[model samples]
Target: MARQIFHRSTSTFPADKVYAVMVDPDQLQARLDELGGPGAALLVYAADDGGVRYRLRHGIDPSRLPPMLQNLAPTELRIERTEALRPVGPGRYAGTVGVEIVGTPASITGTLRLTDTAEGSEFVIDGTVTVKVPLIGGKMEGILVEHVQDLLASETAFTQEWLARTYT
Candidate 1:
C-alpha cells in the first residue's frame, strides 16, 4: 500500500527570496550540515535557463528506528533525494522530489509548489510513500511517512533561519 504525505509551510520571506536560497548550493550545504542526518551530502547540482535541480544523500540512523523496524532494517539506510524546480508563473514555482532508499524496496515521490503569500510564501509538498515488503509494507510506509514529515519540517525551519540570517 502507498501512504500519502502532505505538508505546508509558510515563510515570512517572499517566494523569490525563498526560491533563491533553495537553489543556492551554499545555503543548501549549510542546511545539510545542520539538519541533514549523518553522512548527508550534496551529490549533484545543475541549473540552466529552464530551472534548477540537485541531488542529495542522507542516512537514516538505525538507533532512531522504532523497535519493530530495527530488527528488520539494515544497520544504516542511505537515502538519495533529488529535487527540481522551475518557474511556473510570476511569483510561483513548481517542483518535484524523489527519494530512494538504497538497497531497499521503499521510495517516496512528491510534487512541490511554492507561491507568494500575503505574509511571504507558502511551500507545500504532496507525496506518497511506498514499501514493497508484502506483510509489513503498510506499517513501514507509516513510519517512513512520519520520518519524512519530520525531516521536511526541519528543512523548512532551516530555510527560514538561513534566509533571515543571510538576507535580513
Candidate 2:
C-alpha cells in the first residue's frame, strides 16, 4: 500500500513572484545549499511560454535514516526530483512533482497548486509515497512521509526568507 502525503504553506509574496523565484536556477541552487543534505545540485532547469521545469538531485545522509531503514537504504540515499509548473489561470499555477530514490524501491509522485491569496499565495501539495518492499514497505513509507513533511516546511521557510530579502 502507498502512504498519502499532504502539505500546505502560505507565502507573503505574490504567486507570480513565488513562481519566478522557484523557477530560477540561482534561487533553486541557493535553496539546495541551505536545505539539501549533501552533494545536492540542480541538474536541469528550463523555462518558456509553456511553463517551467527543473530536475534536482539531493543526497540524504545515512545517519538521518531510521535504524530500521538504514539497513535497507544505501550509505547515502540519492534522490532525483523533477518538478514542472504551468499556468492554470491568471495569478494561479499548477504543478507536478516526482521523486525517485536511486537504487531503492521508493518513489513519490505529487501535484502542486499555487493560488493567489489576499496575503500572498497558498501552496498545496498532495502526494503519495510508495515503497515496493515486502514486510517493511509500510514502515518505510511512513518514515519517508515524515521526512518529506519536514523538508517541505523547511523549503517554504527558506523561500519566504528569500522573497523578503530579495524583493522587500
Q: Would you list the clashing residue pairs of candidate 1? A: none
Per-residue lDDT tens digits for candidate 2, residues 90-117, read 8899999999988889999999999899
Please list the C-alpha lDDT of all candidates, in the order they appear. 0.90, 0.91
Candidate 2 Cα outliers beyond 4 Å, as residue runs: none
Worst 10 residues of 1 by lDDT: 68-77
Please name the candidate that would achieve the greatest lDDT relative to the true structure: 2
Candidate 1 TM-score, C-alpha based: 0.95
> For each candidate, what TM-score against the reference?
0.95, 0.96
What would the per-residue lDDT of candidate 1 be over residues 37-77, giving only the tens digit for each residue?
88989999999978899999997788888975675556787
Q: Quote the lDDT for 67 in model 1.
A: 76
